[model samples]
Target chain A: MATEAGDNATLKRKAHQGRPVSLMRKTVIHALLLGVCLVFMAPFAWMISTSLKPKDQLMAPSPTLVPQQCEAQIDGAWVAVDREADDLDITCLLVRPVGTSYSQVILPDMLHEGYELLQTVDATPDRPWAKVRERLPGGEFGELRVVPVSELRYRAVPQWSNYKEVVRHDQMKFPLFMRNTLVIAALGVIGSLFGSSLAAYAFAKIKFRGRGVLFVVMLSTMMIPFPVLMVPMFSMFKWMGENQLGTWLGTFKPLWVPMWFGSAFNIFLLRQFFKTIPNELSEAARIDGCSELGIFLRIVLPLSRPALAVVALFTFMWVWNDFLGPLIYLQNQEQYTLVLGLQAYQSQHTGAEWHYLMATSVLIVLPIVVLFFIAQRTFIEGIATTGMKG
Target chain B: MALKDHNTLKGLAFLSPWLIGFVAFMALPIGLSFYYSLSVYPLYDEPAYVGADNYAQLLWEPDGSGGYGDALFWKSLKNTGYFALLSLPAMMIVSLGLALLLNTRVAGLSIYRTIIFLPSIIPIMAAAMVFLLFADSQDGVLNAMLAKIGIDGPDWLGSEAMAMPSLALLSVWGVGHTVVIYLAGLQDVPASLYEAAEIDGAGAWSKLWHVTLPCISPVIFFNLIIAIIGTVQYFLQPYVITNGGPSESTYVLTMYLYDKAFQYHEFGYASAMAWIMFVIILVLTGLAFWTSKRWVHYQGE
Candidate 1:
């Protein structure tokens, strides 16, 4: 085309320029689109990267992101990083007695105290400073050059027992937290979705007196900040526990009972989706002697699968991640949800073993991440279909 | 005509599950919440009929402990409002931009859509943790990259000045839902209209402005409404990332209300907060709906 245009006069070249102009537009759009997509994806990329970095690298200056090669001292032999080790470093800050003159001490000499902080330099075969230099800050060329192995005050050791310690803590238990979270998430989702679906069906399909008023009223409930109701709901539940419903409903009633009725938000969403279905379909069913209930069950329910799946998935995610609700409703440690458990872990380990806490957090977030990965397509469809009104 | 009563009853019966749930969960809780807002319901004793004391305290009382003079409640409301104002518009623009991208005949368009939508499905708990990895102070990937460009990243989620904006930026990543809606709206736009504009010597920009904008105005309105409502109720990201931290710069209404109810066990006060929030959402939504008619072009209309 360029050769042909070159063979022609100036008029032909001018006409040929139009082709490139459209090409430029296409190129610009594609570039702009790629940039926007990357912006949308940056967070997940950051998350996965952070999850893989080693603890020392986590807080290091120019942290070695590609896990560094390190020698692990095992049975008096040097093992590589990620290699099995029988010995582990359990670094502890030994506090001198309050009245004593020494402010604080890092005890390398306390060999009989059961924990031995493994020195990386001592374990490496030759040029141990090279290994130490790689692990420590300032690298090969800075003020802090590696001293002889004996002079190093601190030893970096792995704490394999920390995970067990966290799980078995007396004030908090991990398994029970998992069980409670599962129960609450499962029940909350089922109850909220089922209850909301019923209410939504009414709002969407039924023609009754005050239907408009009822919908407005239902929507009005959305405006009431949940915190406003939190106090009343809590008191009511505690009161119920102490008196009337206590004899039968048990303490968990406050947490799960409201799900049977419906959430205004879910009802609103379901109703909107339901309205999209043809009214004539229901009318036809009625003409064929099908009851309204039959139409809802046999027709509306089946056709509304996409919306229902969305509602279920959303409800499940919310209930699973809910922190404040379970904290307020269930006082028993045995009844604590996964979020509460994380909070409890935060409280207990305010200063130490944060790596284990991070690990536990990974455990907590893993299932939801997996679920999201599985149902992500359906979830998007649901959100997009639900009407842009949050 | 005689069978109409029976038909209505049948319709009502189909709606019964929702009706019963509405009264039990939505209506009853809301009413009780209103009543509780008007009284004092300390956990250890009977709720005293304080009769507007909670409302008065929320609005007028200067005492730091209980009344309208309370700094925490006002602060949280202010913070929440600020978040909503900033995040809503940003979300709309970004989501629309995404819709424009996905609107093309890209190779593996569905794959791109799924990848873009992935974050929206991530439970806030997980995503928030992941966000912290990138937004963390000193050593996070974001700051590390910024250093290479000779620009220093602020302590993002940790800095009081930048915290809310950081949270807002985090929200832009999960706009796949809005994008999907915009894509649907964009697809609905008739191709002939663009063709007509082109024949009239309109450039691509003018064609998009005159034809595409008017066609998808309603979708924009829908996205706007949802964004506003969702922002007003914003809790999860701020709550998880900063823990409303760096000195409560990101403290939000829901979290403060949560503190009042569960942490302090101030039932009446929390209820009042919730009620105030409800009013705010109602007013905002009403405003959106009112303004929508002017800018939003309904296809049928």
Candidate 2:
């Protein structure tokens, strides 16, 4: 494919020969790309931001990406208070009048004798400091008070320890989940690389009576959604469990053991990659009296490192991010993967504490993100080939 | 014949692992699923043959005021249909546009590609958590941002009217995978084709319409088929984000099938539902391929 620098230069030169690309066009192109990137990247940024924030600010309207510590003085002591909307239309503010429990939204200018002036917030949700609470002797919250916006102190105090706290959480055995997930991932990657490569080698190189038919049959299987087989597969595993056939139902076997067979998608991908390697190499090995398996191991497998890496990475990813399989197969708490554990954590402790949930999510996704950076070219090429080479 | 037999033996030996897996996992299950579809297999007892009563009940009770077969069934089908209608085009167009932009000689292409690709690759469960936070009706970042500009945002997941659309919005956010595929297809287009179009005095828009789209039509077809198959069995995100909430507006086929199979333990009925989904995918994919003959141009074929 003419897709490298040479192709780019020739296309750019020939397509617009009379006029070079203008600054206006470049700026517009960049502007569009930036907007798209912002949409794509904002959720990740927000996820990490919400994860590191304190529980109090978890539901703050117009939440900030940065963790903030803004306080105001009420009853002569600084306290944290939730603010109303960041709308800056009206004059004056609402405060707990130091006596009544329910404070009124009042005009600050109306009270002449005991009223003090208060500054309007900076018209951004970033500066909502209207409410105040008393910081008691041992760092306990005393009361919720609506404070004047005046004399408010603000600082970016990010709760970077949320990651640590989530790990240390009682209900979630983060380390145990990590160990289980890694165990499954390791088995799955091994199964896929060995199993899919061998099958792909057969389909790509060897002549069989029904090879074409079998290959198409395998490709067609890719179109069948998991839901179609979800029930009967469950029944099959249940039968295994009922007959005491080596713990298929409630064990990791149901999840990772299937990969020891061929995956249609990975087999297809590797077969394409295998065919691209010259057939003469295998012939030369054959002439040297190498067996079929020996040629596959010594020549084909070593030469197809990139394809194997792609297969391994993809298989690892599927195992890591798998939800439905774990949702059904694994029964006990001790058998939970990170994704299942996260869902269980959410269902157990719903809504109020999102910091922990988001933090747990980030923890689950962090390894895949790291792998992407480590094998950037392989990941990109592998993904692109799956779609195009089809 | 002798040589063929020898090669066949070796090839079958190599493929033994996959062959064993297929018989156990796919072929056996599919056969049992069909058999179960005819019986009342509720896991507690041995499955009694109930004939096609499950299918009859599901289909006859169209309760047309609702989903595909029964009321909830029809509703699930319609909901999935509505989602597929919105998400497929939105992802295709946006990803194609972004791919075209990226295909141009741009500074910092890798940075943009990374940003775009990372979201699509993240765990769907994690992405759902983000959407859950970002789309909260009252205190969500989306509503808050809308409020800043003096427009109120709707209750995204909380409202029946907007729940599927909210999922669609999230779907668009992860269009990076499709974009990468499109970029690969675009780069594969020969530069000489563009040069020829230029010499023929075709402008940019005409050239894009005539030359570029035709070349990438197969990629589009592939994306459409994957998206359709995916949309018909949409789960995970809706399960995590909305849970078919706000009056079951986001109740999709797979979710209902899962509930029937796992929750209610009605393995037989769920198998029927699974077969229905299978038929839907086959018909839809068959339609795409049938239509592709007109629009999808294979250059060397």
Candidate 3:
């Protein structure tokens, strides 16, 4: 019994020793995962950081992620300082006669807009102060003040105005581009759902003579690289513009119109989903005097909401993010999508204006990121299902 | 027979939208592209017949001396091939490794998955902007980080030698989607196999080799084909970031085709190039499938 007790104590001791090892393992795993997460999130964080930075700080010798507030030399040390109120009178160090006493005095009727020296004055015993000028609130030059020489410095501040400047930039009309993109994406999603669902219903349920052959043909279109069709498609659209649409070249028509015809992938996804629904429901609806269209609208469509959501979400993302289509079709700046406008902004101002450029990029990507978060499940499901099937 | 005929008619009615779209969009363009490949069809002009000339000029052009005018076809092909070779295996390995790591029971796994996958969803143009900011020579965050480690970072997108590799690095950053797909594949691997391996005294590495790999080989094969096709048609990254610049070192085939068709108005030549790309993709895909039979193990097969 004593030996048994000793063994039990030893076992307890061993268990107690094992805890730290397991904890060490957990710590290592967490550290690795966190490290990987940091690498992945670094770029996005950089974008946001750059977007918040002031123009001067953007090209600093060593850029920092967090935007720093303005600093001023105070008491012989650089320190962050608040801007002097507009209503306050400007103060200056005034000298009376050469080698006389220096006094801190207010320059009356002068508001501190920003400090600059107009001209240096040679001081004599009679008029012993150096003359400096301060620019007032307006562009008008203020009277020169005779004062002792003092250093002036501007503090670095986060430029929240960069976002405004980006949106209202002269070259790129960001709001208009966003409107065009939204219109195209919305219509594309609607048309894709309307057209692809109809086709998917037919492919899933309707037993046609050439159904098998046609389905295979439609699926095969997914394999065709876009570059192969790019030339002819361009020619076709150009021809169509000249002949039918009265100039569809520099318009949003080409971007969304093709979507109205139903994409192959969407049709495949919806069809696969539609096939899983019990045939009895549609049959009952048909027996109850519902037409095929009626059965589709009332029975199949309502039941296939999740699948349809997946299609709509994915289509929305594709249309929103489409760069090549807009680049090929939209010639005029007014018809440019957000993606095209962002590219134009970057190309026009390559290295400089990074803050504004990043601001615009954030504007362009924010919606998609938000949408992904909201419909995260649908995205994962759609990707998983499509990937597995492919 | 009449009822069957009626059913066929109804099915055709339902299929009309896709049918019309297929003919107008897919079939017609495909046929027209082929015809355009064989003809000199500049934009806004009727195509002139030039049978096999475009093909011969592009394919048979000797280096530095003869054939087509300013033929960078071989150069672009080499660059694209180099990019695919470098990026494809790297992406697969990284994504697969991430997938395996995430497959373990860990805290905040969903958040980790979401964080990793987030980059893939960002628009390529926007992603390019972010990459450009981080990759800037002097003041870039990446260079700053490298400086802390006592190494000077090279100009990522600026230098010709590093341009394609920089794009590949960007590609790896957006492997979140690939990783997610791989995670799904890993999930489908039955736990019983792993348990059985463990019971048989198999270590972690051996279990991965013996059980995990074979089960997920099909997924890997699928991803490989997809990645190849994607890399072959790669356009937006180079277009947005490099614009096929620094002496056209990063110029892929698609960018070449885009320039030919849009910039230079060499529609026929571009069409030929597109067809060549199409054929290359087909052959590569076929090769992948043929090779998959040896290694891609299916459950219950």
Per-candidate clashes come to 11, 5, 0
On residues A243-330, what C-alpha lDDT tens digit does candidate 1 reach at each position?
7666312245566667767777678667777777888899999899997668888998898777777777887777777765766677
Q: Kindly report which residue stretches of model 3 are placed more than 4 angstroms away from their true locations once superposed.
A: A1-25, A71-157, A244-246, B63-70
- Residue-by-residue lDDT tens digits, candidate 2, B78-137: 888999998989998999999888877758988998998998888888999888988898
- Indicate which candidate wins on lDDT: 2
lDDT (Cα atoms) of all candidates against the true structure:
0.65, 0.82, 0.79
Model 2 regions lying over 4 Å from their true place? A1-19, A71-152, B61-69
RMSDs, each prediction?
Answer: 10.2, 6.1, 10.5
Best by DockQ: 2
Q: For candidate 3 chain A, which ten residues in a row score worst on lDDT?
A: A1-10
Among residues 3 or more apart in sequence or in different chains, the pairs in candidate 2 whose N, CA or C atoms overlap within 3 Å are A81-A131, B67-B74, B67-B75, B68-B73, B68-B74
| Full ranking by lDDT | 2, 3, 1
User: Which is better, 2 or 3, measured by TM-score?
Assistant: 2
Put down candidate 2 lDDT per residue, A234-342, tens digits, no spaces. Answer: 9988887788776687789988888999799999888888887787899998999999999999998998888899999998889988999999899999999999999
Docking class of 1: acceptable
